[model samples]
Each structure stands twice: as C-alpha cells, then as structure tokens.
Target: MGSLSRHWPRIAVTLIPLVFALLHATGALHLGVLQRLDDIIYDARLRATMPRTLDERIVIVDIDEKSLDEIGHWPWGRNRVAEMVDELFDRQQASVLGFDVVFAEADESSGLKRLRQLAQAELKDQPGFVERLNQMQASLDYDALLAKSLQKRPVVLGYYFTGETQAKGVLPAPVMRRSELQGRPIRFIGWSGYGANIEQLATQAPMAGFFNPVVDSDGVLRAIPLLSEYKGEYYEALSLAMYRLLVGLPEVAPGFPREKFFGSRSYGGLESVLLRHPKGTVAIPVDDKVSSLVPFRGAGGVSGGSYRYVSAADVIGRRLPPGSLKDKIILVGTTAQGLLDLRATPVGEAYPGVEAHANVISGLLDGKVLFRPDYAVGYDAVVLLLAGLTLAFTLPLLSATRAVLASAAVIAALVSLNVYLYSAEGLVLPLAAALVMCITAFALNMSYGYFVESRSKRELANLFGTYVPPELVDEMVKDPEAYSMKAANKELTVMFCDMRGFTKMSERMEPTQLQELLNAVFNRLTDIISSNRGTIDKYMGDCVMAFWGAPVDIPHHAPLAVKAAIEMAGAVRQINEEHRAKGIPEIGIGIGLNTGTMCVGDMGSENRRAYTVIGDAVNLGSRLEGLSKAYGVEIVASETTRKQAPDFAWQELDRVRVKGKEQAVAIYRPLAPAAGLERPLLDELKAWGAFLRAYRAQDWEQSDVLMLNLQRMNAKKYLYELYSERVASMRLLPFDPEWDGATNFETK
Candidate 1:
C-alpha cells in the first residue's frame, strides 16, 4: 500500500495530457498554437518536395527594370499598352493573354480628355478649325484604341475586391448568382466593394478575375478562395477564371457530397468546385469555405526558374524571337520593385504575385491541388488519443533511457505518417497537438521521478532543521532512512529557561524596544544551547523549552544539557555588562535541567503540531525553573542530571515534593566548571554543604555558625543569609518527628 501511494503523483500527472487530448477530440478546445505549428511543419514538407523546375506552359510578360527604363515608368499611356497587347498576340503569337493588372480608372495620361476639354472651352476656335480637331480626336483617344485592341481577343483582365463600402468601376457578369444557390448548403467569401476595369475595357475583355489573395493572420499566403460572393453574386479568382478560359470556357458550378455522406448535419459546406464543359466534369478541390491550398510549384519569377519571363518592352519593340511566346499562356504583370506585387509564400518571402496565379493555374490543370477534408479533425483526434494513452502507461513502467527512446519513436512515427499523407495523398493534416502531448507527458513523468520520488533528504531537513543545530541536521540528512519523528519513550535530557523580572522590564520600555531586547536575549541564549548540540523544542514568551535525543539520538544528553545551562548563566552576565554600558536595563534568567525517560515526538492538534517532548520529566523541568527564584540560584537541575555531569561543581538546592508529584526528588544548582574553581570557593562550598546537613538534622545552632561564616566570606551571597534566617525561625516552631527536610512546593 505504501509503494502504491508513491505512484499516485505519476498517475495524476499522466492524466493531464489525456485531458488536453480529449478536449481537442471533442472540439471543445482549439489549440491555435498547435495549429500554427502544424502550418509551419506542412510548409517545410511542401518546400522539401516541390519540383523546382520551370513550367513552359505559362510565361510572364514582366514590366521589369528594363521595361521601365524603356517604357517611361508605370501607368503608361493607353496607346503603349495597346501596342504591347498587339505585340503579344499579333507578333508573338501567344495562345492566350491575361492581365495581372487593373484598369479601374480611365487612361487620362494620353492628354486626350484634356485636349477635348480645351477644345470645348478655351481652344474651340483656336485649332485649325473643326476638320483638324476631328482628325486629331481619333488619334489622341488612347482609351478607344486600347479597347479596340482588346476586342475579340482571348484576354483575361484582373481586378481586386475591397472591404470598403462603395464599389468602384464596372464589374462583369458573375459566374453564379445568389438565386442559383437557393437552399443549397455552400459557403462563399463575401465582399463589400470591388475594383474592376472601366466599362469599355471590362465589356471588351473576354473575361476577368479578382486577383486578391487571402492572407492569414501570420501574413502568409497559404489558401485562396476560388469563388467569392458580393451583393448576391459570385465572382471568380484570377487563377480560377484563367483556368476556366484555358479549359475551353467551362461552366462553373458547386459540387456537393451525397446526403448519406454528411448524415445528420444540416450542411457540410462545399466538397469541390465543378468545371462543367463539353468533355465531361472536372472537379477542383475546395474546403468548406470554398478555399484551396496554393500548390506552390517552387519559387517563381526572375530569381527562380519556375516560369520563363519576358520583358514587355522587348516584346513591344519587336526585339525578341518571333515565336518566343508562341502557343504559350502569356500573363501580363509587373516585376518592378515599385509595383509592390510581391507576397510571402511557403517557397520564399518575396514571391512574385503574378507567379502565384501561374502556380494555381498549373496546379488546377495538373489536378494536384491539396485538400483538407471535413474528416481531418477526427483523424487528428484519434492520433492524439492513442499517442497520449500509450505514453502515459508506458513511461512509468520503463527506465528513463527506455522511456525517452519510446517517446522519440512515437513522435517519429507520427511525423513520418503525416508527411507521407501530405506528399503522396495530397492531404493537409494536423501534427503538432499529438506530438506536443507525447513530449509533455514524457517530461512530466521524468520530472516527477527526479524531484518528488527521491525526497528522503528533504524529509529529514524538514523534521530537524528548526529544532536541532545545523551540523546535527546536516548529519541526519545524510542518513534520513534511519530516523523519523515518531513518538516513543526514550531516556533524554530536557531543559527549560525563563527570564526573571521580564514583565516589569517590558512595562518600563516601549513595545518595539522590548521586543528587540527579548530577541537579543533569546538569540544569544539559543546560540549557547545550539552550540552545545541541544535541540530547542520551542520559545514561549521569554522562556525557551528544549530537549536532546529522540529526533536524533544522543547517547550523552545529560552532560550536554548541563554544559548548555552553565554557558547560559554566563551569557546573561555578559549581556548585562553590554546593556549597562548602553544605559539599558540589565536582564537575568534561570534555567532547569532534568534527565529521565519521556515521551517525545511531533505532538499537537490537527491545526498545528510541534516536534517536542512531553511527560513527567519535562513537567518537573519547568517546575524546577520556577524554583530557581526561591533557591536564589541561576540554574537548578534534577539529581539525575547532577550525577551524570560530575565535572560541574554542584550545590544541593533542595529535596522537594513539587506540585502534582508524590515523590520527593532531590534538586541541585550547578555552580561552575569544577576544574577552574579556586580552593577558597571550594572551601565556601564545603561550609555550605555542612550547614545544610546540620540544618536538616535540627542542629540550629551549628547550622547558624556555618551560614554566618559563608555570608562573611561573601556578604552579597543572600542564599546563605536566607538559610541563616530559616534556621532561626525553625528553632522556635515545633518540629515533627516525621520531617525529612524535604520542602513541599504546593502552589508550583
């Protein structure tokens, strides 16, 4: 049962990872951190497996530095664009031409509108008359020329949508209308405003697509919407519209899974985007939001060789080979730094925006678009559950090395399987949640084993650090398994010390000053006992209760207790000398020591417990401390302690039946170190012992003579003077025949 109890923490921490896994499985929690990490992992795998070769099916007519140098900067005149359009189809013989640019505003850079306004207001009568004006009107109207060039051509114009309230320019007919969706369950991204080509240019172009890329919170272009809805009408993306035109103008429709496939749910969103044409049905992959992951075909444009790029200036100037763009899907866009058409993608940071559309076009043509199905959540949850449970049960049963190796194998398997699904099956599945759970479970187990399971040393420190000396505690900690604080009867030494006149001293000083003085006295007295290797049980007011043995055994507790009592008496005198010099009140203390078998251990109520001793021996020690005032001595000890420490000079204080005790016990005062005392003091001690014998024997006259000699040698020795008065008073009273010279302390 004890061994089983130690494993409880390991079992509890293991359930933590399982809880997270369960929450994720139930869709009650969405770990966005894990999702983002999985996104990064998917990107790395995508980049590692991408075919880094050029696709000659699509070519970009880049308005590069060379083109800008020759063509005189951006927003070029309409006639210049018209000339490039003619150059691509008529001269270069391109199969299809798409504009990755917008013609939202009229091309007023031609100065044609200004010239007409001037002709109507100021220069109406100044030109070569109406004939010359009419002839220059046809030549200067560049918008008309550009519009005519676009008429009846396979040109796909690009535009963008905005979150603004007001729409801009003219939008073409939508591919699908809201009325067509009628009750069908499908989700489409909605927009508030759009920027399309002007009326003439839009009507003249064969088709147009909004080239806006949907950026994520982390500012990465990962997924794009093939179709978006605005004002109850649906518009196609630049890539989607271009793919449609390339595939013989397929009709756009929403594809849905069978009703049996979705079960009880009201809607399952879009399953795929259908491209219906004369040949058959071509299903383009799309998620619930009708968005597809951008299948990046390596880094494209000028830096990487994913697509061939030709300068628009060279094409317009007829400087390139005749069939340079022959039968190629030509996309007209800018690679100039000033255009700001670069984007952050999986392959590179400054990925060409035009090349992004090209990759989508190629992906749709090749049917290689990645899909994240509705069942991906279920798939991830199952993996997380299995991995978490496996690690939870396995780690605790194995050693550290084997546990780590097992965790590594689990993580490697998960990653390998996820990557295989991504590369071979074109599936986008989550991987981070399960991997993090496995690693976290393993770490929790290892940390618990290292810190909590191996805690014997900490237990020892906790038990003895507060009571015993630091050196003793250090030694006990080294062999903690051999000791415990359990109550038991053990022969030990216990001491109690209390300050005399503390109540009156406290009344004379401020509270703070009294507290500081008390702290100084106790700190000094405690150091004396601690230096002698005694365990301090507690400090109660101005008194200190301490015991030696039990918490850690000491074979010679009696001598240690006696030695500590002697030092405590000397320490009080030294303290008083320092206090008298500082004009502070001096203090004094009385200590009592005893040696006997007593019960000792951690004892108290449930609210608080203290590692201490309790029994008759401990109580007698406290009573003896109180008797020190009556005996006129600094220290009082039981005869048991006096007999054990023979190296100390002893003065028999009394034989008394203390309160709550029937037996009369002999008590004595420890005078000083026997080796250091002079012969005169020894002679005084001899005279005092003889006086005690005579007084107890009822020989009052002889006892009086002995006490008088003791007082004459030391006139300030009030104890002998006290005995002289007692002997005189006893002579007048009737003596009992049963009297044994044992005093009875009835009040305690």
Candidate 2:
C-alpha cells in the first residue's frame, strides 16, 4: 500500500494517453491520424498475405487496347456486342457472363434512327426505299439484335449509383424491399440517383446489380457494399448478384446479431446477409455499414496472373479453339485506360475497377470475406483498457529496461492476435487505438520516472551517499520516504578499529609521506567495511568507526560486522608485507565488535553535524578495541557479538571491568570460521579450556600441568604465556571464596 501511494503520481501520468485512446475508440473524440495509420497497416498486411496465385474458376475477358484497335473505339455497334455474346455462350460454352459496363442509352451507331427519320419524311416519296428498309430493319436494328441475344442467358448486367438526384434508364427489381425489414430501421448506404441498363436490355436481362464501391475517407476502395438502398428498396452489388446466381438464386434476408451484447437499442444494423435455400443457409458477414472488405487475391491487370485475362477480340474473332472456356465464369470488362475504370485500392493505386468486382466475387465464392463486426468498438475498448491499465500499474514499479521490454511484448501480442484474426478467422478488428495507447503509456511512464520521481531519488543519494555504501543508498532511494536522518535508537552492531605505531611513524617519516600512507591504509580498510554492508560512522585520530543495521534494516548485521573485522585484520597483515618490501615502518590494527542497542543518526553541533553512533554499547566496543593489544590479538569481540554470530570460532580472552563501567563483560578474540578450524587448533583450544578451568579454581598443581601441555602445543603464543605467569604469581596468594573469575582495569 505504501509503494502504491508513493508511485500514484506516476501511474496517473501513464494513464493520460489511455483516456484519449478510449475517447477515440468510443467515438467521443476522433483521431484522424490514428485512422490513417490503421489504413496503412491494413494495406501492408493485405499485400503481404494475399494469395498471388492464379484462380482458374473465373476469367476476365478484357477489352484491351488490342481489342479497341481491332474493333474501333468503345461503345461498339450493338450487332458486334450481340456477336460477342453469342460467341461466349454458344461457341465458347461459358457458363455465366457478367458485364461491368452500363448501357444507359439506345445504340445509334448503326444509323438505324437516321434511316427511320429519312423513311418517315424525306425518303417517303421513294418507293423501293421504304420496302427495302422494312426488309433490312431486322438486321439494322442493332439494339433489338443485342437485346435478343441477351434473352434467357445467364448474364448479370452492372450499373452505378450516384449521390445526385438524377435517375436514368431502367432499374431491375430490388432484391429486398423496405417492408421486408418489418419497419426495423437499418442504416444502409443510400443513393439518390442511378445509371442502369436501357429498358430494352433490362427486360431481356432482368438480373442486374450496382457496381458502386464504398470509398473510405482517405479515398481508397477497400470495401464494397453488398446491399445498398435506393428509394426504400435494397439492391445488391455486382459481386453479390453474381454469387447468388451461381448458388441457384437463394432468397436474401437480413441476418441480425444472435446475442444482444450491447442491448436491444444499441445497434440496429444487419450483421450479415443470409442466403436462405432449402439445403441450408449461407451467411455473409458485413460491417455496421453493411460492407465487406474486398479480399484482393493479388495485383490486377494482365501480368498480375491472379485471373486469366483474355482479349475480347480473341473471343469475337474465333481465333481460339471452341469450348476452351467451357463452364468458366467470365466477366466482360474493359481494361483500356481510356475507358476510365481505374480505382485506388489497398493493394495498388490505379487498380482496375472491374478487377475489384472480380476479387469480391472470388472471395464470396470461397467464403473468405473480411469484415469489421458491430462489436469491434467494444473489443477496442476492452483491449485498450487491459493494455493501458497493465502498463500504467506495472511500468511505474519496474526499472527502465524492464519497462521497455514489457511494453514491446504487449505490442507484439496485440499484433499477433490481430494478424491471426485477419488470416484465420477473417475478422478485421480495430488495432490502432490499442497500439497507440500502449506506446504512449510506456513513454509517459518512463518520462515521469526520469523527470519527476528521479528528484526524490537524487535527494536521497545526496543525503546518504557519503556514510552508506552505494548499493544501500540505491536501495533506500526506491522508497526514500521511509528513511530519514532523525536520531533513533536501534539494535545495531557497532565496530571500532584503532591503528598501532601511527605516532612513531609520523615522527620519523615526512608529513606528506605519512599522510599518503594513512590515506592508502584507510582506503583499503574502508572498502572491506563497505563491501561487508557496514556504514562508516567517522574516523578519529589513528582510528575508524563503523556500524551496521542503520538507515536500512538488515537482519544479519552482527554476522556482517564480525566478518568485516576479520577481513580488516587480514588486510593489515598484507599492508605490512608491502611496508617491509618498501623499507618503511610496518603498522598493525585492532578491531572490536559489539552488538546492542545504540543511538545512530546525524548528531553534532548546529555548525557541523555527522552521522554517528553513541551509547554504552558503542563505548564498550571502543574499550574492547584497546584491549586487543593487551590480549595480543588483532580482533576482539564482546560476548554479545559472539552469541549473535555463531558461524565463527572464538578464543575467550578475559572478563574485565573497564574504566567507565563497573560491570565486567567477557570478551573473546575471533579465531577463524568454525568450519575451517584445523585439528591441531581444535586440540589446542580444548587443552587451553581445561587450563583456564583449573587456574580459576585455584588448583595450582593441575594448572601447572595443563600450562606445560599448552606451552608444548604453542610455545610462542603470548596469551598462554601470560596465563602461565599469572598462575605462578597467584599460587602464593591464599584462595579467596569471595573472588569472581574476572579481571579489573581502572585506567583509561
């Protein structure tokens, strides 16, 4: 709870971007840049995953430049169109044919209308002219010939819808009427004007569809409306019409969402268009706008190789073998540039508009059309919430490197899920908002941590950097509010180390040389103390003081302090070796460790304050350091420190009363780690223990015998020799029953 409270400001900063993302997702605020980025992402994904292989089921009979050159300009004579239609169905045996062009006016290229005017007025006086014209009428009437050729054929005529209010030509029967919806308002793409086939061709070919595609705000054609509204009647697109005709003309009905996930009145748009047949029902998914994303197979045009492009002149000229295109669905469209049929698509700019229809028809046949579900907005909101909150809460707690890695992982997951849905499930969900939200949240979090929260850490580092180790200072800065320099008593382990021979060395050596040697020695010793997690208190003349379990609570401070003292003794021995090689004076150090309650914090006069410790335990530790030289040992520790640190072996020094204290305390010299003690040392300590017992009991004869054995074990040992002298002197004194087994010292 404290950690959360400390980092709440950072969490709030990270959530700033999430609010904007949610607004953009829910339509409260629209971000045009995000939408444009989404379009670019969709385009790149489509191009990368498109099946760039040939589709043999459908073929495009392109009226190319070659055909236009061979047959003259566009809007060729209707007799020629009739001939082409006859060749496609009768000669080539194609199963279905769809025209991507509209015939809005009657064909007058054959001069039939001019001849009729002449026969009615100017040429009325001519006798054989009228009779000859009547006989040639059947062949000259190209519109009638073309209409007759289209009769009873499996042909789907294409038309276009416009936003203008002008309507022209005739429209085929709508696939669905508004009454069929039962008055439920469905928001369909509505158009006010249309250009359809002529009445003559409409009557011959009753099946027709509009070829209008749904253009995005960026002017890219990515989807086509399967059903649009005109005068309260719903019409189908060219692709949908062709697909229905292929499927035996199933009944079209609106498919509503099965689960009202957003409530009844939330959405009234059709979820899909159901093709109801006796066998079963085939549902084609649509977006809220009743549009499906065009599943482009590959690039368009002759060299694209997605669909076989046959020149119209080849079919009309009978240059190929008959029945070569037998049972193949053919789309009659012009690919000539002058015909103006190009459109900008996701896969390519200047894409042939006719090929767009062909791609849609191909997708419809394979049931692989992609769509944005009506719940896509809800999905976006949920994903943004999850990712945003995850980053907002987690990034503040993690380090900079970890935060970056976490954010990258989140983005990769979102992209992977989105791509899987697009490729495997044919779902086009919104991804831009979620992606932007994650990135922005991470950036905001990192910025806040670096700029705002770093101030507190810097202040903490400045306050504690000198007295504590860098690592401890780093740890304290994570929660700087929990620590302060106010004086407090704590159960701490205090250490006092004093140097020997400093006065003699300073008297003989130059002042600069003595200062350099002192600094070098202190530097090496202080490193060992800091490495062992000790906080340096202060440095007195020829002495250094330190303690543990302060500013940061450490449960094992006694063991750490004891270990540091041991290492510091070893460091002095090494320094003596260097002094011997340099022909300089050698030095010695004595360290004392005691564990007890002590006051530790910044304490001094108002002018100059120092973070130090002061209490009875601290004084006892200093007194123990002075006793190290008397006991002929490098390190001395109180009974309390030895009890707290059981990992090391100790040789009992003495129980003595110091100058300031009346109570006697037992002190021991740390030998080595208990596990590393040698057999010889162990036997010697056993013998020494027996000698102390006998000497304290006034057993003079037994003490002398044990002393001889201890002398033989280590003859040059100062401690055992000193005990032997004491035993010899005390032998003459009478034994006092009131005497306690402790030594007393009255001097400072």
Candidate 3:
C-alpha cells in the first residue's frame, strides 16, 4: 500500500505534460489574458530607470539648399554665415552652437577665382615662373574670418563612425576607449565622410558626437551607440556628450568592472554605457547599438511631431523672446520640405531622426530605461530549485482533489508574485519553469483521477457487498489509495442511527408504499449528511451509518458530524409532522455518536468488499442508539463526544447499560429541542437526568424525590420507574469498581 500510494503521486506527475501540450495546441493559455496590464507595468518600470533631463545641448542651425536658393546659389559664401554667427554670440549671447554640416575644401569666392586667373597669366610664358609667382601671392582665405569667430566661442562639430573596413570618408578621433571598459587593449574600425568646415573653424568646437542611427531587427531605433572604441580609444555619441555636460560626472570612476572589448551588454559589442560618479558607476541601459528605449508620450507616427523650429532668421533679426537663447542648448535641424531627418522608433514608425537623441537625452535625465543583463543564470537557478522542491513535498500528502486545488493555487500565486517582482522590484526571475511544474502536476493528477483512479473506485464499490453508501464508492474512485485495505489508527467521530420499528411499518404498508416512504425519509437523512461534508459509510436496511475524520482529514469533522446529526433529526421531524397532518402514521429515528481512535479501511473478501470502521467505539455507538428509546429522546451521544464538542448545546439523559448488561455509561442527547421534543418534554428529560444520576449512586432519596416531581409535572413521561428499580437494586449489594458502560449481547 505504501508503494501504491507513492505510485499514485507519480501517476499525477507523469500525465501533466501530455495535458499541457494538448492545452497549448488549442491556444487556451497565453499571455493575452493580461497583455494590457503587463504593458502598463513594464512601461512604468522602464520609465522610472532613465536620466532626468538634457543639458549643454547644441541646436542644429540648418543651412539647407532652400536657404541657399532663396539667398542665391549652393555656397552661400562663408562671409554671410560668419555674419550670422557673429550676431548670435555678440548680440543674442548664444552659449553654444553646433553644425551638422562639414567643409572638406577651402572656400573659393568670386574675387579669389579672378585673382588666380590673373596670377597664372602673369607668368604665362615663364613656365615654372607662373607656379612660383602664383604661390608667393597671399591668396584670400574666404572662411578665415568665420573660423576666428567660431573659435572664440564654445561650439561642437558633428562627425560619424562606421565599420565599412575601407574608409568611406573622414572619421573622428575616439573619445571612449577599450581601456576604460575592458582591462585589455581595444581595436576599432571607422569610415571617412566629407567635412565641409574649414580646418581652423573645425578646431573651434570643444566636443562632438557621431550622428549614426542604430536600428534593430525590427527596423526600429530603440537604442543608440553611446561608445564605440577604435584601436585603443573609445568615442562618445552626440547623446553621451550632452549627458556628461548635464551631470558633470567624471568620464571614468576610480574603480569599475571591466568588460571584454568584443561585447559587454545587450547593445551588441558596443551597447553598454558606463559613467562614473562619486557614489559608484552607473551603466546606462541600451540595446545592440548602445541606445535606450524611446519614451513616446504620443503616437508621433510615421511623420514625426513638429520640433520647436526656432528660425535663425528671427534670432539674428532680434524677433525672439529676450532670454530664450540666453542659457538654452538648442539643436538646429531642418523641417524644410525636402530635407529628410526622420526614422522609425519603437513607439513611432516615422520618428524624427534627431528626436532619437532627444529621447536618449530625456532618458539620461529622467532615468527611466531598464537594462537586462547577459548573465542572468543565478535568477533562473533559484526559481527552478524552489519550484521543484515545493512540488516534491506538496504532491505526496494531498489527495487528488486537494492536490489539484493546491497546484492551481500555487501556479497562480507564483505568476502574480513574479509579475510583481518584475514590475516593482526590477527583478527578472524565471517564470517558465515554476509555471511548468504547477501545470504539470494539476494536468497529471486530474487526468489520472478521472481516467484511472475513478474506474478503481467504481470497481471497489461494486465489490463491497451491501456496503450501503454508493457515493463512498465514487469518492474512492477519486483517490482509491485513500481507501487502501490496510488501516491506521485515527481519531474519528462515529455516528450510528436506525429508524424505529421499521419492521412494523413494512407490515401494514403495500410494497410500493413502503418503498416510496423509505425513499423520502432516507433522502432527507442523506441530504443532511452531504450538506455538512460528512461521509455516509452505509445504510443497514432502514439504519444509516456514518463516520467523520476519515478519507479526508477534516479538522472540524466532529463538529460537522454533530451538525449533520442535529440536521438529520430535524429533517425526520419535519417529515413526521407533515405525515401527521395528512393522517399518516408518525415515524421516528434514534441517533447515537461516539468519538475515539479506531481502524477504518476496506474489508471483506476479494470478490466482495466493505468500507467501514470498527472498534469498541462502534459497538458503543450502536448501544447508545438502542438505549435512546429508554431515555425517551431522538439523538444520543457518549460523554467522549460531548466533551470534545463543548461548543454544541447538549442535555444529559442517563447512565445506563441497556437491556442485557452490567455497568453503566453516561448518555446525553443533543437537544435541538424544538426539532426533537416538545417544550414540556425537554423539562421532563432534564428532570429524568436528575433522577438517573441519583439512581446510579444509590441515592434513593434523591431518585424518589425527582420521580415524585416528574410524575407530578408530567405523568406521560416514560423511563422513571426503570431508573427507580435500578436505584433499589444497586443499594442492596452496590456496584464494583471494574464496572464500565458494557452491555452483554444475547445475540449477534
């Protein structure tokens, strides 16, 4: 049986995978149940982990070909642009400015173009003399004044980085290097692009960021490259430059964890962003491109929202607010019809390309991005260990019904807990493994109970000859192992009850009438038993047998059994009252209860079986029911039951060894008095107990005293003389100390 019970748990464990697969195939379980809720939680979590705001920002002053065509031709002459910058700094007091454009060649104004021709002619016949004379002349540097103007103030220039192997254009020097992140040396590859600024002017800007948008597999710009090292030095992106200016954090903290040069975080090889401060170093979370998730407050869609397009024409014209450009870092990008600066982002397909930088700057300022690490094995191991160990202990002691219920509850609890940790605690523990364990146990146990164990229960029921309660057979089917033939000592509440003079009722009634009447009374009693979750052991002809705290360890089984008894007596009384009104014969039943340790299990032969309890308690319960008539009450219980059930209302009836025995036992009736007796009859029962106690102690004076009062109060009461006679006899020789409530049986 031990082996079988162990196997029962395995049966539940084995079949779950099959059921889960079936459910999965049908699409019954999915995250869609709470997709909206999960989104909100994840979004809020991501929002709280990014930077607060942007600083030292440079606004791109777009000198699009449109402004060029409106003024004149392609090169709008460095003189005009130089004049604009001079007015911006001197009059408007603009703190900083950056150009998204570059100049690789020297500016050739109309005057210089004419001077070169005249110089070449001066040495026309002189051969090498023409080159010598032309070189000697001081050629006009058109952008020279513009370079000086930009150099005197703070300005940052735009540059880019690439991995084209063969350089496509000019590349910038590295600012973020491998030594800063990795303990080892680093290597980088880059491309060359056209630079339009004059070399002297390019040196004027203090910092710069390569404006290269990194897109993920879905073609969304979710993250950006914060650092990309080349050879041994790392360079910063436009967003990073702005962040450093904002926070004033040292580029490198004193001691920091070094990652390998190849790949450190989820942002591919160069995705991680490490910044140093007094407290500790903080890693800005990014995807493969060292970019963070964009927080789009609205659906900016394919066409990005309008930026605060501050016109350069207005600022130079003094057509702006007084302190608008005083201390602000402005990015000047084009919104003119043809110049495109838009790209797709996670929240918007057509987000402004420059807005990606703005979003990153916002993230760094707001601190709302979440980072998932590459090394998350520790969290997974903990979850797996907890789930596996808990299931091991939980599956063994539980029956099929309880096991399945607990498994469902555990799975739901784990899911809720994990979701909370993920959202609130920033924890990313394994959810799959624990979920699998719960689903596996429930699916296996239920399928086994329904298909396998239930069939056994029906068979066990079929084998129990005249076992009475057929539902016990069904209950056994749910967990046949719970009904094993081997018995263990268990404290139980046993109830034995029988209909009074059922044989006499069979005499006058026709067979059909008897069947109908028995069915009605039996149905009422069965209702009471099941309503209180008590097991009906069987029905012996017109008698009902039941026991509690078996098959299932109900903590309050005693109370439940007592409650069922009280209810059963009331139901029978209600039926009797209806019968009396209809001029039918009244019926009555006697109920007895006892609580003690006993052995309960399957009994009888292989071909026939019985699920019943047996012990001295069982015999006593039957005796008490038989003595109920002598005590003139419907329900009687032993003192053992009355003690454990002190919360219930009870009336003591007698100390009697009924019919065929010596020794005595105290018997009491649970008087739901309105249900079992008339108001006067209850007074008579109390008066009777008063008389019986005296009789047992040989107090004839007290017994006779109570008998005289009882006869006066109610002459219709029965059993007074029975106790009076016993009192007379006990007084002659007295009872022995070895006496108990033992009744000698004349017949089996």
Q: Evaluate model 1: give its TM-score.
A: 0.59
Of the candidates numbered 1 and 2, which has the greater lDDT value? 2
Which of the two candidates, 1 or 3, achieves a greater lDDT against the reference? 1
lDDT of 1 by residue, 1-748 (tens): 4543567678679769868865865579877777788778878988988898888999999989899898888878888999989988888888888889998888877677777777788878884845676788877888898999999998899999988887777887799876666567577888899888888888889599988887876788888899998888888998898888888988998877544331314446777789898899998878777888888878766868888998888888889887778889988888888989988988888888888888888898888999886567667777887888778777777788999999999999999999888888788877878877888888888877443223766677777788788888776765677777788899999999999867988889999989998998999999988888899899999999998875778888888889989889999999899988998878778898999989988899999999889999999999999898887888999999998888789989779999999999999998887888999889988988898898888888888788888888888876776777788789997866788999899977
A best-first ranking of the candidates according to their TM-score comes to 2, 1, 3
Q: Which model scores highest in lDDT? A: 2
* Model 1 misplaced stretches (Cα beyond 4 Å): 1-12, 25-27, 182-185, 258-267, 452-748
For model 2, the local distance difference test gives 0.89
lDDT of each: 0.84, 0.89, 0.60
Please estimate how well model 3 matches the true structure, expressed as its whole-model Cα lDDT: 0.60
Q: After best superposition, candidate 2 residue 266: deviation in angstroms?
A: 3.0
Candidate 3 least-lDDT 10 residues: 260-269
Of the candidates shown, which would achieve the greatest TM-score relative to the real structure?
2
Model 3: how far residue 592 lies from native, Å: 87
lDDT of 3 by residue, 58-78 (tens): 344444444545555444566
- The sequence of per-residue lDDT tens digits that candidate 2 reaches over residues 370-479 is 89888788778888888898888888889899999999999998999999988899988888888888988987788773432778878998898899999898888777
- Residue-level error in angstroms, candidate 3, position 627: 99
Query: What is the lDDT, from 0 to 100, of the residue 565 in candidate 3?
Result: 90
| Ten-residue region with minimum lDDT total, candidate 2 | 258-267
